[model samples]
Target chain A: MGRWKNGILITYLVAIVFPFIFLFLLSMSSGWRFPDLLPEYFGFKNWGKVAGTESGIAQSFLISLVISLSVAVSSTLCGFVISRYVSYHPKKRLLTLLTYFPYILAPVVFGACLSYYFLKMGIFGTTFGVVLAQFIIAFPYALIFFSSFWNEKIKSYEDLVATLGGGSLTTFRKVLLPMARGLLMVCFFQTFLISWFEYGLTSIIGVGKVQTLTIKVFLFIKESNFYYGAMSCCMLIIPPVVMIYINKKYVFNKLI
Target chain B: MFLEVHDIEKSYNKEAIVSELNINLEKHKTLSILGRSGCGKTTMLKMIAGLTPIDQGVIKLDGVRVDEIEASKRNIVYLYQEDLLFPHLSVFENIAFGLRIKKIKDHIVDDRVIEMIENLELQGHGSKMPHQISGGQRQRVAFGRAIITNPALLLLDEPFGSLDAGTRKNMQTLFLRLAKTFNITSLFVTHDLKEAILMGDEIAYMDKGKLKIYKDRSSFINDPETGVLAETEFWKQLKTEQF
Candidate 1:
């Protein structure tokens, strides 16, 4: 039984680690054919060209960072505030049900549905347009994520603060924000991931003009440039990896 | 009267939850309100604290009309049954919360919080987090947090309900000591008949949203509606039947 468990664990670890190792090796190699076990060239030749303008992956990475950060921040803060009202509202159930509306339709269809309004607002091919589009999807997720935060106990805490002579701003700054730090970090990371990896919505709203990293990955794949595709895929996993590390090291440990 | 609640009424969906509630409590005294669950004790306390909006009533604190004021401005702290210590803060910080909110100077806050921690008999536990403390210690922290604020009135809704009997007795004694030390005016709501008689300088019984304040503890014990007679009879009958 012990051996069987060890075998399953090893297999699972290998399954998880295989893609990452393959992506790294594939990103560093070129001119490899199917019959060849390894590529003819495997070094930093492609890696060094990342900073040059030819690939533009650096610019794509930066743009993707900005869009995701904006969406994550706005959506997390708005969701935190809005979820409180929804939690205490008389029609709490109805309001909660409305948060799931964006997920009802697929992202591609949702983006397509919003294309007309995007064009009408004259924001269709802009970076701001992509941020707004991703926000539409990410915001609801954050709302649902934070809906569990407000309850009778939290309500009592708020009232307790008020009666202790703390005003609304003071109450939030002193009590609510401190209490919610861990959940807020978790929500921000989740929303950032949602915006970071969003592909279909970016393509429709950005109109091939705003080349985020995800779009660049697809573009590379479409042009049969597997090396660059693998490289961008490698880059795509970095932020989430760092975020997970920070969350584990700082947030979850303290929460536990 | 230090706290005045006049004709306060609260209703839900056209049904009255608390109707024509009235209370007059003097300064530096505790008014113990005895009522069972769903008897509008909490609603009455919330209205006085300005947490729940009253349908039609006036509440005065220190001779000033507070019904129209925000809860924060009313200077009435309401303690729940739970200790509700802020998890992110240390015991010292939890006690110091109100002072920080009022933006009191750091030195004064330090002095007062240190004094309060000692007063709460939680000297070395000041650096500990809420989860690290015992239930009795947590309740002491909650009380320290509230009393350090020096509010005009304190409303405690069965604040020691979750404690074991021994701890509850100790907390009651501690509360009386602290209340006298701080000269705190409060309305203590509890279902325990013994606790009501022990905690209150003035006692009141609530039934169906109306409160009847007793002239004295003897009167409170004599009033059958207060249920003291039945409780006494049960104790007497138990004493005779056993062994």
Candidate 2:
């Protein structure tokens, strides 16, 4: 049983590590000879190019940043606010089910179905259009994540605050917001990462015009630029990794 | 009357939760309301605090009709059973929250909170967060937070219900001491009969949305159906057995 457990652990490690090793190596490889066990050339040329202002990689990074940050901040805020009301509603289950509809469905299918609306609104091929599309997916997740936060105890706390002479604003600022602060950060990063890695929705809604990091990655692959694609993938993985590290290290989620 | 609930009514789905509930509590008096679960004790407390709306009644505080007033402006503090201290805030900060919101001076807030910490016997633990404290200490912080605001009415819903027996007893004693010191006007609701007897100056019993306030504590103790009389008799018999 011990050996079997070790075997499973090793398999899990390899499953995760191998792709990272390949991606790093591919990104660094200046040239790889055909039928060779290893690359004939190795350099940081692809990585440099991705970071350099000459390549559109930096612009794609900024675009993805704006879209992700917007989606994250807005969705989390709206979700936190709305979920409180929704949680106590008579049809909460049905409303929550509605929220899951956009997310649980295949992203490409979801995007394709909503593409006509994007065009009709003239938001297609714009940054706002892509951000809005991702928000649709991310907001529901925020709702679901925060659905259970407002229980009877929290309701009592709200009353406690109100009765202590704190109005709605103060109740939220002093009690609700502070209490859910860690979860807010979690939701922000989760939704940010969701918008960051999103390709299908951006493709369909942005009409391949709004160039986010994921779009750039696909462009790299489609153009057979494997090194740059690997470089983009590496860049794409950084934020979430940093976020997860912060979440584990710094955030205080719950005492009990 | 310091606080009055005149013909208050509430219903959910056509089932009355509190029907024509009426009570009066004089200033600086503690009323301990005893009831079983789902007996509308909590609802009545919330109604008084303006946290829950009353269907058909007026709630007056010191000659001012406050039922129409928003809960935030009511100056009534409700301490829940679970302490509900803000986990992110230190004990001092939690106690100082109401003062800070009122834009009280920094030194004044600090002085009051420090004094309260000492009074509550929580001197060194002031800087610690709510989660860092024991359950009994946390309840003390909640009490401090509510009382420091000098609320017109303090409503406690089984404030020590989550504590162990020893801690509960200690907290009850501390509460009574503080109630005397501050002369706090309060309405304490609990399911425990002994706790009700110990906590309140005037005892009231509630069942099925109706409340019966005993004019004297002895009458409340001596009431037949409330089980207190039988409980007292049992204790008397046990004393006889001991002798």
Candidate 3:
């Protein structure tokens, strides 16, 4: 049994980590060529080019950060309210189903639909439009995570708070908010990651002007700047790593 | 009349659950609802607490119609079987939840929670999380959570059902003593006839969604029509460890 478990663990490790190892090697390589077991030479040259030069990658990084943070906050807050309301009203399942329609659509197809609407509204290439698109795409994830958590804890606590003469706002602030803190944190991180790494919607809606790290990475790949693209990919991995570390250190232990 | 539940009815899936239920509760009294599972006892309690909606009829508190009032504004605290103490909060913080909801001053919240901790003999346990405490301690914390804000009505749904027999008896005693001490009106729901007789000032027998009130404990125990005698016989047989 132990050996079987170790075998399963190794399979998961290979499945998840092998791509990163290949990408790291590719990023460090001096040249892109086939028929070589390894790159002839490796250096910090790619990292230097991306970080030192006036590459738009840095700006893209910052833009992605802002957009992701905004999307995470707005989606989580709105989704929290919608999910809680649905939980209170058993008859609102149809409304909940309607809210999830965007999430069920193909990302590219949904992006096309949203781009059409944004174009008609004259905000197609704006940062606000991009943020709005990301928010809609990520809202269902937040709703699902928070709704499950709310279904477990909020109903009983709401009853308890109500019995104590707390109004709606008071119940939300005092009971629901505190009880939901952990799940909210989870939703925040999840939504932020989703928005940060989103490529298809951002590319389509932002129309190349409202660039993000993902857009920069894809652009570098298109330009055949393999080293710079790999470096951008590496940079793209940092925020999620930092987020997971912080979550493990601060949020995980207190969540229960 | 501190609470008047008038003609309250609820149904699920087009089937009647509670039909035109009416009851009057005064201050500092114990009303125990004895019923089988799925008999709408819990539904009635939730309706009174405004946690569940009434399909028809009205609930009034102090002669003020409260049917449309939100559950939070009803001032009806409910204790569940699972204790439902906030796992993330310490015993003191768990008890302070109701007071905090009422936006009581921080220092007073501290004082009252501490007072409850002492009164309930939960002194050293105040700093511990819900999971760190015993079942009895958790139940006491739940009771403290409900009573801290001095709610106009307290609803208990088999609050001691999860405890061991010894702990259940101790909790019953503690509950009665605390209820009397605070002069708080309470409605308790239990399947155990012995529990009803021990804790209830007035016993309500409910079966098949209909409620019949008995005069008092002895009358309830002796009356064959109320099914109390049969239930008591079952309890006695179970206590004697006879099949």
TM-score of chain A of each: 0.96, 0.90, 0.85
- Per-residue lDDT tens digits for candidate 2, residues B1-243, read 998889999898899998878889999999999999998988888888888888898999988999999888888888889888888788999999999999999999999999999989998999998878899999999999999999899999988888999999999999999998888999999989989999998999998988888999888877886779898789999999999
TM-score of chain A of 3: 0.85
> RMSD to native for every prediction?
1.5, 2.6, 4.0
Judge candidate 1 at residue B79 and give its lDDT: 94
Q: Indicate the docking level reached by candidate 3.
A: medium
Give the CA lDDT, 0 to 100, for residue B64 in model 3. 89
As a whole number from 0 to 100, the lDDT of residue A131 in candidate 1 is 97
Q: Which stretches of candidate 1 lie above 4 Å from their native place?
A: A1-10
Candidate 2 lDDT, A1-256, residue by residue in tens: 9999999999999998999999999989956767887886788777777767765888898899899999999999999999998998989889988987886679899998888898899998899999899999999999999997989888878888888888888888878998888889888989998899998989999887898989998898998878888888888888888998888877844422
lDDT of 1 at B23: 85
Poorly placed runs, candidate 3 (over 4 Å): A1-53, A91-100, A103-105, A251-256, B55-58, B231-243
Q: Rank the candidates by lDDT, best first.
A: 1, 2, 3
DockQ list for all candidates = 0.88, 0.82, 0.58
Please give the fraction of native interface contacts (Cα pairs under 8 Å between A and B) kept by each candidate: 0.98, 0.95, 0.86
User: Cα lDDT of all candidates, in order?
Assistant: 0.94, 0.89, 0.84
Error of 1 at A239 (Å): 1.2
Best TM-score among the predictions, by candidate number? 1
The positional error of residue B1 in candidate 2, measured at the CA in angstroms, is 1.7
From the highest DockQ down, the ranking of the candidates is: 1, 2, 3
Q: On a 0 to 100 scale, what is the lDDT of residue B139 in model 1?
A: 99
